[model samples]
Target chain A: MTVSSDTSMIHAVGLRKSFGSKSGETVEAVCGIDVDVRRGESFGFLGPNGAGKSSTMRMIAAVSPISGGSLRILGMDPATQGPQIRARIGVCPQEDTLDTELNVRDNLYIYGRYFGLPRAEVRSRTDELLEFVQLTEKAKAKVEDLSGGMKRRLTIARSLINKPDLLLLDEPTTGLDPQARHVVWDRLFRLKQQGVTLVLTTHYMDEAEQLCDRLVVMDKGVIAAEGSPLELIRAYSTREVVELRFGIGEHEEIAPKVEDLAERVEVLPDRLLLYSSDGEETLAKVHERGLDPIASLVRRSTLEDVFLRLTGRTLVD
Target chain B: MSSTADDGSGALPGTLIRATWVTDYWLTVYKRTWKGTVISSFVTPLLYIVAMGVLLGGFIKGDPAKLEGATSYLSFVAPGMVAAQAMTTVFGEVTYPVMGMIKWHRTYFGMIATPLGIPEVILAHLGFVLFRVATVCAVFLLVMTPFGVFESLGGVVIAFFAQLLIGMAFAVPIYAFTVGLKDESAFALVFRLGMIPMFLFSGAFFPVSNLDAPMEAFAKVTPLWHGVDLTRMLTVGNIDGPMVLVHVVYLSALVVLGWFWAVRRLTRRLTD
Candidate 1:
């Protein structure tokens, strides 16, 4: 079949994926979600572990089969044109799928060859990707010698050897330190600026805010909310949050006292969160009501706060 | 970006091109580590010929009628030793290496993420297995020349191809078993249950006809005996055309069937 003439890099309608568990039952990992990732836009799937983020990414990478519904990657049906779609897309999987047998440079070279690129072209692109990922110096080293962050960069570099139209990163910086994470984010930002349509999965709200132009916050195999970070915050959360830490075991009791002081009151085990348009005003009213908190802080609402509003749970454990 | 079109029909030539790239990767790996396998590939074959044919044959005085239709025990054992060496080397190639690709190193998973299909991956691996068998058996033939193992060079040449065919027969099925493994210990079970039994009773050192009827019949069922007897037949300059045909067809059938089974298991594991 001819490639579909679509403007979007990825278009999915009611995408679904399921696995047969050991108990002889089918467990749905991604239950019918529509997704449209347009050309040159950075989109993300923001979710905690077990949210089906990796499963969806695998299907889009054309490495996993779809159990139900439809998925078109880069305007070609993955079921029929998996190799064709994968040829045009770069994928940095959640797991480190790098070849341990080959040294750093050969990983990129072999991956490019898998897409049927010429040897000289793969060699030149290998050098270019090593430079891009700041791994030129380590090109001759074994993959085992590289640290976790360095391995992640090499995987990213290997994915791009084909110069794909679309780039998919699953948990790109999940296990990296803050400084190393920023380095990855910076490189990704550069790729986005170069007009590579990027799709990534991350549970880190800051990462979503830093890299994604738009995203879907997924939970329990479904999309809970979808928007830009600011738009999600503005729609689901107040302008600010006042975090109040009270004396031992007083949070639940004091939560009722501040019920009328904000748009919403959430009582955690250690603290009470007052969601309000004006955090200082909410704190002042809490004091006027004789509710003495041990400590307090006013902060601008973030995607975490938005996630809390939509899912009634925190983003990370 | 370059055009992302499927190669016409995505069969034969397209599969071959991609499979060759995969073979190239293995070739690169082999270039690095082949030096380390010199013991098994070259030196080990030499030791086996000396120990089994020359050293051990010095003792046996089989019935003058025939030592499995050979005048000397060395002549009978030489061909079997070569065939058995091919089996051992191919077993090494397809077992842990296959498991490592599927599970530990995740190299196959990485390839699947790219445009390489599972069929290409399988074909490329078995191609490398073929190469491994060729190199080991070639070294074996060179080692055997001084021992006067072959009646003629042309006959030895025919025996060499027979060795290759038998090597594939062993490799394809063993690879099928390796792909379905999760734990490394399962390999030990295969060694104890399948490899060792077949290696010992495949008439490499003695005739299987000496065994009881049940055991002899069982030896005939294993592919290695066909390899050993056929290689021996050609090596001794004896023409049993019908029996040779039977051996070729049987080993070839195993290679084809085991290949499909391997492809199916790999596709299921990697794709799902």
Candidate 2:
């Protein structure tokens, strides 16, 4: 195994990926991009659907080949040392690829065995992971019998069987309930506290704000912005946001009336978002104009506003 | 327990024992489901021998010359049944299970995501199939012994090895084909169009010399034909030097060619 002198957990330069269509056209999935994930940091890729987040994660996992440029994981080149790179990283793919034929504990055991771990060592680790995922009671249950959240947790636990240095999670909490998502976030937070370098991709702004120490916002196969949640908000968004609902289709008409009250007015289908330094003062000014129609609330600026300001579109939409 | 102790800095390339972990997985599954597999592997073959060799041999009144110097039809068809059983079991094991692991259950995808590469996955699975063939052939040989078909135990052992060779000769290519398939519909056609015809015309039930000229020539070139011939020779203690070498070389060549093709196809399909 060849190790590089670079200290970054993951390092890439001008990475690109393209797929060939039947008519000889090429679709560039991941356009040229540069990324560096430092050790012991939870780095995130925040993007919408079909934004090439999963493709980039797959390349980092060493399962998919890099079309051009360079990628190094755990200081090893993925092109020549893929298996060695894969040996050191744990990947939780967007889809749960757990073996349905095996029980919960066996899933971890078999994956550990694939990494050539000793039987006794795998046994102990399986028990520990099952408990860590809060599935010790369901350890013997078949994988298909678990709920969606439980299965996702098991996939995360399975990825940890080899105790990899870097963990790649693709939409880890997607399709999960609020409580289940929180549970997953709590486990991930603990892993981060233990100094596991985490790399994840998600479209949920809250998930990104809660878990990522640093992140890059991607759109149309390119990095649009990159920073910590607070830094990105401070750089691109106002101090507070006022959400005002005038009527069903009256947001367009009310946007101009309140356009002068805030730094910027964004008209939406059902609401008008007024970006201002003091949202309460902006709301008082709106009420003084006799533009009251339905509802109004002032909240602190978040990553969602930052994403909208960068991409000119909402995160989920 | 806060931090992971394994940095994986000392990871080495995959070895033979690590590859066998795939075989170990199959063995563990078999531990739970072996009872279900016993009938097809043992009982069905035993019934075929009883019906075709014992009861039918008793009904046929033929001269030893016409029966290829055999004293009875029971001894004549026993080795043929052994060879055919190996082919059927090995083919059955590789077909749906291989496809399910690729398309349906996606277990092979799960395996490749780990440190194991595509070659190790293919080798380990084929190795497990070989283990199954050996076990099934051993049981078939024991069942044949009680029926008074074998001339000696040493000869029975030799015939067993021949059956394994024939099974692998067919298995590796079929495995390569299964990896390229998108669905299981083609498996039915393989059984009906390919395996059935070969099973019937490969001189398993009668001598190829009794067949018409072109048909007999076609049968002579089949892997199962060589397998049946070698197995029958070993069963009756009638070993021939030149023909044994010819059969061994032909089957071994198929195994080598099929193995190379399987590795190439599987690596392409799994890796990208």
Candidate 3:
């Protein structure tokens, strides 16, 4: 709620991270990358596995030291003013590190005390967060008893205890069921409506599309592409995407003949994707080829289209 | 990012102190896990004393008793009990507990994230461990006293202080090892190789001279040997100034070395 000026919430330039292996080989987790997260915007890092999303998230959270870069959080250097910057930031890490020893309410209470909150204020806020997360009845229960979705929700509630100016969530709903995922997304959307700055990393293109105001797709520790989801879809893809599937090996024989029907054509292992501004026209042209595919579906261009256009595969790989 | 103006709160004098306060908050974790700490520090030592000193005391002769310069076996064994108790209590309190915080629980990471530096974490953790060791040692001393082990009031006090010193000495190396512990094997090695020999050969049950020549020499060089000697001297009122000097010097050296290593390791781990 306390918006301290409209300055950029987080900024980093030429950030890099590398870990030395036992064989004296150094694995570059994050190559030189620049990023800026302005106030009141949902930012996202969308990438496949081992694309350095976690390494970047760790550096931004001030939990891991940068190898070679200048980084700032709330306009303060994380290298020097990590404590000050962290004081106002909430980070929900990729892996849940919730204290299992304490009850759900105590978990919030103890974490709030870590931020030096008055004990009375912490108690009041814990009550509020439990209600917000719809966990009022389960506040006295141990963390180990909670389901995966419930634990994730508790973690999100714990992060909001200090009412942090900036919130960082790494894959916020990676392993949740669809209903649970929607519930998390709904809560995050509400936080965003209140103008909280959110930075999230995810492999789900659908998640990025749903949450991010702006996103950067990364590959092999480098940014492959960056833009708003809609902007990316428009810039990198057509207005519609047609997926054509044939009976097993039939795709190979018919795929090469359907290339001229769309603006761009991609022959995948299981299917063929035809990109065109008009889906009906492309499908009519495909019908004119005198070949029948097992199945075909035309959908509007999405962030997944952008991902496929840039990385030559889906984001979930 | 604002590249020029500085807030300047980073240099606050109370920052480290506040961080220690935050790190101290983790002691609440013990409210749920006090059983582990109790069993290792107090229960294990009590069992050792009861099984070795009480149960076996009737079977062994108490004359010149192989432990030279001792009037009775019980007197010698009693002082040795204090030293042994101190080493185990201190070692158990600091080693696995500190390592659990660092690697297993990752509680230090949570602490460091909240403006608490690694040194504050170290200091707070050590302070808590030492306080716990002192309390457990006191309780052990009192418990043994009812069994007629504490001959003089001064003996009880000497045994307490001796345990504190030896426990601290063992804690120093354990703290140093904790920073480098990549896995549980390292601590297993500490218990098996480092502490087991010190327990058996460092004049805990019998006098060091009773051991074969090389074994006695090895025991003489150990911190626990000096601790036992100092405690025994104080208990029997045959105090030697040089022996006290050796205990102080050895323990002081270990403390300095361990603290320096821990600080260096933590700074590197935090900053790097």
Judging by lDDT against the true structure, name the best candidate: 1
* Residue-level lDDT tens digits of model 2 in A144-202: 99999999999999899888889999999999999999999999999999889999999
| lDDT value, residue B66 of candidate 2 | 61
DockQ by candidate, in order? 0.59, 0.35, 0.34
All candidates in order of lDDT, best leading: 1, 2, 3
TM-score of each: 0.96, 0.90, 0.89
Clashing pairs in 3: none
Could you say which candidate leads in DockQ? 1
Candidate 2 residue lDDT tens string, B1-272: 12222333323334454576665577777887789989977798789888999888788776667654456788888888889888888789889999888878777777877767776788888888888899899998888888888888898888888888989988988998888887899999999987888788897788888899999999999888999888988988777889999999999998888878887887666655
lDDT of 3 by residue, B1-272 (tens): 11112232556454554544454265676666677767665676677677777778667785564654455666677778777777776767666777666667665666665545566677777776677768777877776676665557976696687777777787766787777667666777788898888888899788788778998898899888888888887776676788688788988899889888988877666444
After aligning candidate 2 to the native by TM-score, how far in Å is the CA of A67 from where it should be? Answer: 1.6
Give the true-structure RMSD of model 1: 1.8
Cα-based lDDT at residue B94, candidate 2: 89
The TM-score of candidate 2 is 0.90
Off by over 4 Å in 2: A1-3, A22-24, A244-270, A281-293, B1-13, B61-71, B209-212, B238-243
Clashing pairs in 1: none
Fnat of candidate 1, please?
0.61
